[model samples]
Target: MQRIHNVTQLADLDDDAMARCYAYPRQLDRPWVRANFVSSIDGAFTVDGVSAGLGTDADHRVFVLLRELAEVIVVGAGTARAEDYGGAHPDPARRRAHFQRGIGGSADGAPPPIAVVTASARLDPAARLFTDAEVAPLIITTAHADPDRVAALQEAGAQVEVAGAAAIMPAAVLRVLAERGWQRVLCEGGPHLFGQLAEADLVDELCLSTVPKLVGGAGGRISLSASGFDTPMSRKQLVLAEDGTVLARWARR
Candidate 1:
């Protein structure tokens, strides 16, 4: 173990610089799960029952950049419900960076699709995830989920697939993405989902922004699992924003 010292201020990083900093590995044969989350100094990932309440402008900037870097965004149904998740809407700058990576997009430069993981397949068909999407959403659920609900989502324009028998397996989800050539995977979590991926050893990288605040409440941690395990990770990058938000990138060691 080594002490981290001599850190420098990293402020006003231009679009290109931010993209370069968060770019996925150049060559990837399989899905590389990268989770992006914002947390308070006291380990609270949410305030007033939503994560957006915990993020600052600096954190939101990195969040958008990370979304541009990913080919697919995965989220838990619970998070999707809480955040009222919608399809990705990449701005011109983000779209340009996305295509510059040699990843072809739709004629109108649609952003990557959001894939929702749910065991119950309980999602709103009228939600923005389906209505406001340029690309159709992908729904990954278990075979035992209510067939009617699964069919409802399928009818609502989601490409539904069964990835598990009774639960949504992390490996199965990655396999589905890998088969579709989605190598750069980004997961926006609601804690429980992050816990599953971490437990399964499927998480490759984590981009975390430490918001400068102390929200003392019953907010849970950034990850939750029935059991706990340790996977050593090395800090890949550290950027201190002027607004006091600290952006950190960590990779499994």
Candidate 2:
């Protein structure tokens, strides 16, 4: 992979080098919050109700790199359900790269945990996300969430927590994650949760994969901004693959 705008050449960009490229910032005032998403050149976030249609081999590579670097993976229940999320299985190659770079997880070096956001408490108790987790996931919801459903989920072995009363609050979400030492948060989103995070001005970085296709469908943009709350972003790096897929890193400004 090679950078385009600045024209920086990378020799193969092997796993170790890639890990260094996206290593979590050393000094953070609070937990470092980042999001990853893929879209077509025309800005279609998905096709056929999923993001799989607009991806390339390189995109998949970056996806794993981002997830491997995170301390916890955050996602809206919609995206989790749509994608049928399960345990983040161990990646031996990534583990080696992380060890070489000395940017890996805790001493135990286990797979990062998953924290899910839901307002309705309707996630499946038997879903592989719960049944196959290496570490139990954190289910975040509102105080107004369905008590019976939450009880059912608890019975199924989930750490359920209430983040707000009428709705889930983004600041509270980060606070909860921080309280648990999950500083590097990766939010793989559905637009509603993305909108809320943007509204809260909590996103620290966005790793976007712009595929080289034009999928003409009803798909929408990667995220919707809050009304009157425009968060400026500065491009930090731009890498272009041989297949015309562009992977970009943008810091919130």
Model 2 whole-model lDDT (C-alpha atoms):
0.83
Summed backbone clashes in each candidate are 0, 0
Relative to the true structure, candidate 2 reaches a TM of: 0.92
lDDT of 1 by residue, 1-253 (tens): 8967634456756777777777787766788889999999999998888997787988999888777777889999999988889999877565664566744222345688999999999999999999989889999999899999999999999999899999977899899888888878899997999999999999999999999999999988888897899999998888899989999999999
Instruction: List TM-scores for all candidates, in order.
Output: 0.93, 0.92
lDDT per residue, candidate 2, 146-173, as tens digits? 8999998888888998998877788999
Best-fitting candidate, scored by TM-score = 1
Clashing pairs in 2: none
lDDT of 1: 0.85
Give the whole-model CA lDDT for all candidates, comma-separated.
Answer: 0.85, 0.83
Q: Cα RMSDs of all predictions?
A: 2.6, 2.6
The parts of candidate 2 lying over 4 Å away from their true place are 1-11, 96-104, 225-228
